[model samples]
Target chain A: MKKLNFGIISYAHPHALRYASTIAQSRRAKLCAISGDGANSDVAKGEAKKYGAKFYKNYEDLLKNKNVEAVYIAIETYRHKEVAIRAAEEGKHILLEKPIALTLEDADEVIKAAEKNDVKLMLPFNPRFTEPLIKAKGMIKAGEIGALEYIHAISENVKPPIFLQGLDMSWFLDINKSGGGGFMDTAPHGIDSLLWLTKSVPKKVFADIGAKIYGFPVDDIGTAVLEFKNGILAVLTAGWGNPKGYSYGLEIKYYLVGREGFLDVRTAYPDFTVYQDRAEKIYWDRPDVRGIVGSFVTAVLKDKDVPISGEDAKKNLAIILAAYESSRKGKVVHIDL
Target chain B: MKELKIGVVGCGNIFNLAHKPALKNIESIKVIACADIDGERAREGAKAFNAKAFQSLDEFLDLDFDVVEVLTPTYAHAEIAIKALKAGKHVIVEKPIALTTEEAEKMVQTAEKEELKLFVGHVRRFDKRWVQMKDVIRKRNILPMHIRKREVQNLPFPAHYWYWDENKSGGVALDLGVHVTDFLRWFFESEPLEVLGTGKAIKEEAKSNDTFDHFIMVVKFEGGKTGIAEVSWAYPYPSRYGVFYHHVDIIGKNGRIRYTPLDTPVVGVAKANFEMPRFSPLLSTFPDAFERELRHFFECIKKDIEPKVTAEDALIALEIAEKAKESARKGEVVRL
Candidate 1:
């Protein structure tokens, strides 16, 4: 079988190294090249050297390399559209990092570009690949939890050390680059998961986004209440400025209140447990689910539909953008997409 | 016409703490009978309060009582309160009104049809500290209110006692939450427009499926002012020997008023010379606010006026509680 050649566009994203490492370990794909600028380029080169892959200083050069059939765009949020469009134009399949683009127009541009080139465009939302979440979706589909009524998702860090260091990241701290801070960053995963499992789009969103702490230019904490088209309501909270040295955990609790009973999945830090009628019956430990890279490779080799598509990714981004607009305008924003 | 006869239900921790002492203190109220699912509990309560022991609800209702105190497991609050009201008895039910909003509404309807006073035991409303705080807020017109209540789990009861079950107790928010919700409604003088909350069950082997030991809720009222209520059973450390310390701060158009019972100082005289010294009270557990609530219920019955904590008030608090739980469950704001 011909190995799928994969390269990364930038190492600035925290997940970039993981993508590089996953490619290095995967049997279906080979790490082809890495592209970045200055310090990021050096880091990417060092990572490439460690992984025995080529490193390119400019993203354009990496895109032009015929050996790299697919490019994973892990650049800054602002650069996603330009790199994704360029990669698509160069006939390379693209796996773009979340917040598909900072603006709806840029997201639309990337979508148009991918469609125009007839190449695959995947948005990496690794949580979908986690075994427990997979099991949860299956249970919901099989009527294990019955009709889904409510979903409560929480992503919390005991306190990350990042807040102790002054909030000084340019892209992260700026509203223009990051779109919004915590909501734009962590919430998209939950939003996409809700949409995926429920197979529904949000009808309306009410959000409260602001810097509750860590007085930064961008909102470090965000809470959103969404009313889905199916009458299912979801609440999502994201915070970046927790106390230092605390374990980071993501929990999604689905309250599937059925005609007969209820099914709940409480996804703790490392394990996800399913409760049938309030009695926990199944437990899956899925610490090894490398959701981002796993899905990217699965799409390339297995021809499986990418768990997160460009349109789905854009919808999540639109929800976040709507949240921002709601917070600023102090009114509920009707989600059109 | 005759002294209002009352039957005490569920002679458990709250009965011992509040009901026995308060009933002993109040005039025009007689503890005619006592009942508990546990015979020993009924006997203990009867012995403590100098009342007759009735082993079951049937026997308790047979007694000539004008009011029944529904203090059993939260799940039974609705059923028993409705039965008592239908049997021509005023009902003073415990907080959380009922396990679910549907049940609470039914209880309210039964009470209204029977022309009986359905007083929800939101003792915090009658607590000396909370009463003083409410008085200040009402007089000062505090617009935006922030109230927080914290408690370290000294001894957690068995989870089977309805309070721990999400379906029965409505989780921690409904258990300890009704107090804060009722407080906000009373303070704001309006129903909650919306509620957003987050909660989690921390104990690994917790018997009850309701997981959250900590809960935080943000309630928006009709007039644009927001009230935040934080309740937790997972306090990490011990404090000044008080069972629970409640702090409330009401932010208004003019000024902010902060109140904590811990701040109240006790005056004492020294034996040495004639020196008067000020020392804070040890903050012992006062009698349950249940007694005051019950007394108010009796007074309202005599005066032909509505009780302060009416069925509607209880229903409103229960509505807020349910919305907060929904918010915690869905991770979204529930609009009332």
Candidate 2:
């Protein structure tokens, strides 16, 4: 089979940098077009040339490229729906980044557009693919614990002023664009994983979010509680002031307390730790994105069930949307479904 | 060797774990009496240290002791320490010295008039790491360190439960926050110029105190340098209490130094006892800090010299902590 040709939407997100390098080395996919609006186009021009692809200043031009079969939508999270809907309308397969949109209504618009045109929509939901969590999901299903009761997942980073200024795109802290602070940017790793591990849809959410230290317009620290349809209670936390690196302390921890027993996973440990004069960093085995990228490419190639689907993508964002609403309203917001 | 007969007041967790154990390490210091409002706890402490038990403070003060360890709650520190000092006893009280700046000031004045050696247990100053850190700071001038101290217990501590009363303990700000606040000031030897802070009583178990079990304070010193201390005790999830943790990092003009769990040199799979402050008191272990602090306190008494951590220094620490609490309560910067 001819390699499934892939085009990347933008170079805005940090993940896109990794994906651009990985997609070039992929056996099943060929990098075709790299396009977005912004100063990123100049960077994308060189990036596209290296991968034997063209750089389109406009994202729509990339979407119209006949040779590009699927698209990797790696733009700022708030701009997800607008680009995704256009990509879907062009009948392009999409592996959109987490937080498909700022609001569930916008998420719905992208979902309906994909259904109307028939395209595969996959969400990175990265932590779910980690070995420990995959095993935890199997254990929960095998009655290692009777049933899911509560999940506490947290993600923390040290984003001091110097750290934030270092990032080329600080859009993640922009309230209007990112919708919230680190909660909207980083919480999806745990939020999406919690929903996937428990296999439950969220019903209601209550949140306490704040900009405790940096005093950003939106919250850099927050904890949210989600009540799922299966009577599971989940506590989610994402913060940007951890006093160390992005994955400091326990990094991504999932504490699952079921009826019989509990299971805990801290992704940072058992990995090599390196220290600098000023700070330390952790070295872990990078995810075999073959499962994520290859599966999406293969599914698009064989016309089979995509590993992640359009509808499956919306569940996590619904909870995230409800959490933001709950925080704003100072009360639990019920999920529309 | 000039043997010091010590009387320990308030047979609390710190007394049983730190003071009694520390006194035992120094052969020159004999603990003569252990006192508490509750005779049972006092007896328990006395038996461990081979000292007499006294339920009355006056009766306990009559013991043949030359030194007193004011290990009681924050509210009683001023009275007990002052009485001990006025009676011509050299005193080595725990951190904060007293709850208020006024009370601490009086304690300092009384100790000065009596010409007695008075030290507050800012034990970190004795830790080899911090001692060496000070030497480094003297030469290089480390500035703007982010110091965080977190103590998480499995809860229901101080079987006597006096700590639950804000009037008695001043919650965490005066209780645990003082140690960090005191040490931050000690590093620079600079007076606290202003403080802006925030505290929370988010734990339902701590509701009776109506005060915070958590605090994050930013202190600005006279040299335009700053320090942020985040101290909390509200972690309840068993996994979070995996280990009692403390971290201090001083980023210097030339270099930096840090203390973290990674520095412990010992990590075993022992079962964690869900009790006061931590699964185990890491700082109290020999060669850590407590033993060093006690040795320093006794050596100062033998030489008839001022101890490294003096009552006046601790009084300044109390002043800073009170200002931080005020800042937190009023939502404004409290200028000293």
Question: Best candidate per TM-score, number?
Answer: 2
DockQ of each: 0.04, 0.05
Chain B TM-scores per candidate, in order, are 0.86, 0.86
Q: In candidate 1, how many Å is residue B73 off?
A: 14
Per-residue lDDT of model 1, residues A215-307, tens digit only? 566666566667788866566656553333222233333333332223344443253345445322222433333556666677867767776
What are the lDDT scores of the predictions, listed in order?
Answer: 0.68, 0.70
Q: Mind giving the per-residue lDDT tens digits that candidate 2 earns over A1-337?
A: 5798899888777666667777888887888889965425566677888888888988999988998889998777778888999999888998998778877788889888887898888888777666667777888898765566666676655553444333356677677667778677777777778778767777766665556545567676666666577766666767664644433443666756554444556553345556675556544544635457877887888888876676776777777767777656545467865
**In candidate 2, how many Å is residue A259 off?**
12
Give the Cα error of residue A270 in candidate 2, in Å.
Answer: 8.9
Q: Write the per-residue lDDT of candidate 1 for residues B1-336, one digit (tens) a residue.
A: 678888988887667766777888888878888999999999988886688998878878877878898877788898899889888888887777888889989988887788777888777777777788678766766544333333223124555555566666667777777777888888777768888776645443232554776566777776545566656554321222224535464544333455543331121111123222222222223565656777887898878897667778878888888888887677556888
Top candidate on DockQ is 2
